[model samples]
Target: MSTMSAKIVHISIDRDWREVYGYASRPQNMPFWASGLAFGLMQDGDDWIAEGTLGAARVRFTPHNDFGVIDHRVTLGSGLQVHNSLRIVPNGDGCEVMFTLLRLPGMTEEQFAADAAHVLRDLKTLKELMER
Candidate 1:
């Protein structure tokens, strides 16, 4: 397995960083910030399971706080297992978001890095959306 991490600093939105993060953390609110992403809720034992499209990838969200741990299984192409944890923190007049993704067995380091960049870009896009 391989590990990849990204940090996005200074997302200067007017709202409180915690609140903004909380908004993003919700499964129902994903499409608002993520633009094209779609999600559906299902019951999985005692926990709520969120199945959704994150860009071209199929992602599953397990509940957390203003942060989340995502289990992503790629569809329509190569099979990749991605486990990710996300956090948003206050930084100066803005906020900083940190993402850590661990690539499960069978995925290469290069693929993990490439996917990490994509994830960061998505965060940047979401930040822009929140700021505007």
Candidate 2:
């Protein structure tokens, strides 16, 4: 197994956990903000697929629950599985949304940084959309 590293990015939202999770947990709502998945998701059995900027990817998101977890697994067309660990937690006066970018094997530092930036922008978009 290849070792992996993570870069954690987050934003504090001016909303309750339930509200935040309700908006973010829907896979169909992804393309509206997540640039990496600009094409959104298409349901295919128990999994969802996206013909996204990164290419065709099949995704499996964590089951719905009241805890505000939004984790997901993505299998790229190249067959590499990327795990995205995301969460929304109650904070004073609001909630905080966190996204963990896992650095996969063979990814260069520059690529990793770019990917992190992409995720940050996506999170910001999510925040703006939800807070609006």
Candidate 3:
């Protein structure tokens, strides 16, 4: 598969990487930081259902791991699937949470930029919640 344009949006959290990962990796905890899922998610089998602007999306999160990987795949109501790569890695006394935003096919420059901004906002929210 050809690589698409991608941007790594990240934020530093003043907390242990393991602690950050433990809280952030759970699908049930996402509504606190991920604005799109403000109403929270409902478990449907192994995938989670989150209602967004476009409609319900089926999100499948990666299994728990020691490497701090919290990747997920989202299948929108329209059947458009977006794979997200997220990670929490140690940075001295704190940690860095990173999200890889990819420019999908037919995405305009403005839309891609908006998506990056959205991801950044979510990460910032996570930082705030963890630091408090």
| Candidate 3 wrongly placed segments (more than 4 Å) | none
Candidate 1 residue lDDT tens string, 23-97: 777656665554335454444553344445433444555556534233333332244544555667776656776
lDDT of 3 by residue, 18-71 (tens): 999999999889999999888789999999999975578999999999999999
Which ranking of candidates, highest lDDT first?
A: 3, 2, 1
Worst 10 residues of 1 by lDDT: 68-77
lDDT of 2 by residue, 12-121 (tens): 98888898899889998989888878877899998999998888999999999888899999999989888889999999878999999888888899999998998889
- Per-residue error at 59 for model 2, in Å? 0.4
* Better model by lDDT: candidate 1 vs candidate 3: 3
TM-score, one value per model? 0.58, 0.95, 0.96
- Which scores greater on TM-score, model 1 or model 2? 2
Q: How accurate is candidate 1 locally (lDDT)?
A: 0.56
Q: Which runs of model 2 end up more than 4 angstroms from their true locations?
A: none
Q: Name the runs in model 1 displaced over 4 angstroms.
A: 1-15, 34-46, 50-83
Lowest lDDT sum, 10 consecutive residues, model 2, at 1-10
